[model samples]
Target: MTDQTPLRSGGRAARRAARAKALPDHMRPIRPGMEGGTYKPLTEAGVEAIHRAALTALEEIGLADAPETGVAYLTEAGAVQGDDGRIRFPSALVEDALARANRAVTLFARDPAHDLELSGTRVHYGTAGAAVHLVDVEDNSYRECGVQDLHDAARITDTLDNIHFLQRPMVCRDIPDNREMDLNSIYACCAGTMKHVGVSFTDPDFVANGLELLHMIAGGEDKWRERPFVSNSNCFVVPPMKFATESCRVMEECIKGGMPVLLLSAGMAGATAPSTVAGAIVQAVAECLAGLVYVDAVKPGHPTIFGTWPFGLDLRSGAMTGGSGEQALLTAGCAQMHHFYGLPGGAAGGIADAKMPDMQAGWEQMCSNVMAGLAGLNMVYEAAGMHASLLGFCHESLILGDDLIGQALRCVRGIEVNDETLALDQMREVCLGGPGHYLGTEQTLSRMETDHVYPRLGNRSSPKEWDELGKPELVRNATAKKEEILAQRSRARFDAETDRAIRARFNIHLPA
Candidate 1:
């Protein structure tokens, strides 16, 4: 394929080229209920139902009646104070929010040169890994993962067409300094990658340094400014009570700048609230509404993304087992809560408690991701190759997760009905025959693009062929894919002068 290559052929081909240029391609869904399967989008009635429930929770059931500085602010903002750590919000207050919030927003990824369009039923996935695990050739001993690991993983993830975005700072544990110098972790994690992340909710100094890192990587402040650094308004509950000051300040920053923030607050039923999904969903809503008051206080109608970083404690071991059906249910219900507010929501899905890749890992990862997509979440982070939630990263887990993401995306293709697939005449042309002569037909070949998810992880080989090649399992194959990506990853393209500037900011001298 030389630069001056001649490729087009046939009169029909010429006609196609002309038609394509004159009129861009139109879209048709993949035919709803094609095989007794259907997806339902939220209707006006459904939204109203969720709102009514939320109103009842706030007006009646109430929130944890506790005293916190953040809750004190909410109490000032028309939230009814109650006893035993319970507070209720007026339903009118919530209805007013639905009329004012932005439901869609674009997240700046990489240098804003890489951002994702998040709206509608679209969902994105990625990971934030600390303590490198699976890519290792040794024991639990993590590799010296620093800037190199960040760039390495970023490059691999960027090349994966299946991965929607790379969550910033994937390798924080191996970066030497975790406490004071930690935001350096965010700087390095986001340096050359094309992904979205707020500076990992760092302190002011680290945040400043991380911003400096972004300007250097992106060429200038203007370039960095071109892509808004995403931030979070993480609301913390003082046991069913209110948010923290740190959370409040973050929300102020996000709302003031019109930066997207994920306001997540979790209450455990029985442990934190009642042992009911509806009960918990309402509590989560009230928690986020507290965040909304902060956002509205800073700048009315700020771009806010709803989130749920909830987990239930296993009272026996007192472990936060987030990888459970309870969490999945929370995610689905959380999606509804945000939608009710007419805001983009973020949820943690495709998460697992598995220490390594196994059946448990696959099941947990796939179910969570699919559930989030079905709920039409905007950002679904905590992605693949991550083991035991945040224990470390794994090449195998990443690979399998990538495939799982592809599967979830395929599910969202909805339905397509056109001349190519409707095949009314084609069906009539072949149905009566012993064999449907559709194989290798022109329509069959042309439409396979919209038809399948080409798997790079799971086994698709016959027993004989697999046995001849040493019978590798799915995990083994996934590990090999990660290695392949690593070997083939080349340094990102940057002009020498710009490159020098980037290196110089980091105090590294480059050749003239």
Candidate 2:
């Protein structure tokens, strides 16, 4: 036993070295655009019932308060307008729009390597919200989120392998002017990440300037149109069958500018929409289908996402409960509808109602996220850094959520069983002739990186090894990691010439 000690130590060192070497993006254990949809929360009959209900809602209880432009667009597409100023869609019109919808949509990234193909059960997770406050975990306090916080969050997201895209997560509270806020929001997001981005305009007038900024970034209008990396998260409706006039106008401009639009219909369960889960989903589906018709009316086969985001409400306190099991069910059910319609769809997930990234946050974030992935939601927005039921964002939680999503994505990847994975030969060799255990086998060494996903900050150390090193708190380690990433120069920043050109053209609020 004493003579084998040196050999064992050498073998352990070799294994450690092999594990430390990084695998290419395609060879990684889990990655973006992985297929999910294995979990079915809604039966086929349930999906059909919801679809019939949504169509009935559209035909009977039509939406009201469309902007003049939207009214014209919808009317031209075979919708009938009654004296009550409500637009009602005929069943044939809705079917035509659905038929003409762009089914095979690819959300291009500034770097082609990160482009997301949104078809089938492909799943991608990323940050998204309009959180007003930033949660400071150390002091257990919240502060107003600003442009710098948004930029930092994007930079951090750029480094995380599991975060597939970056949407403007927080509002720039410092910029009081709505137009300037909208412009700066686009500028900051583009400067901080090469991944696909999503943003919303406060006013329709701001979209031209926003497109101009994107044009400069893409070198020209044609190039920006060819590969529009950013999408408009347009909440075109005010829930309960009403259109937000200004946001509808913004959606029109964005579509004409050749930008993809996420037709977001976010209805609160007990407040704005119906109280029942199925009823809330029906309202959300009706609203987004209306928006889809509106999009196809403006331009046939335009790139659009069927975004039906219905958030949960805690009845006892009358507050939003983004982290509840009901929220999980709502998102999962929505994914089923998306699948039923065969549209590229998105829904909210991984939001923590907890004030901090504690035990409650972990359970809340994981519960909905895993469900969303399994249900095969195309875009899982707000999958990280959101807290206080979408009222606050935290950098530490975002860092930790990377590991959390890595595991969630692994679940989404599911188990692949093949002859090789069955390991019949390896088991026979080990049990019959070779060593009794398979730990030191060549198969184990070769499959270590391919078959398993190891978390960057998660500790797998035993009690003895944990004691040897000072016991580290997860949040503390996250904070340290966040600082380390931010301290380094941003790999996603624009070139000096482009940065100068943008600053010269727009009122760039973030520090140079």
- Count of clashes, each model: 17, 0
TM-score of each: 0.77, 0.98
For candidate 2, lDDT tens digit of each residue in 1-512? 99999998998898899778888878889999999999998888989999999999999989999999999999988999999999999989998899888776999999998999998899999999999999998999999989999999988999999999998889999999999999999988888889999999999999999999999999999999999999999999999999999999999999999999999999999999998899999999999999999999999889999999999999899999999999999999999999988999999999999999999999999999999999999999999999999999999999999999999999999999999999999999999978899987889888889989899998899988988889977999999999999999887788899999999999999989
Off by over 4 Å in 2: 1-15
Worst 10 residues of 1 by lDDT: 28-37
* Residue 264 local lDDT, model 1: 65
User: Can you give the lDDT of residue 197 in candidate 2?
Assistant: 99
Q: All models: lDDT?
A: 0.59, 0.94
After superposition on all C-alphas, the RMSD of every candidate to the true structure, in Å, is 6.6, 1.5
Scored by Cα lDDT, where does model 1 land? Answer: 0.59
TM-score between candidate 2 and the true structure: 0.98
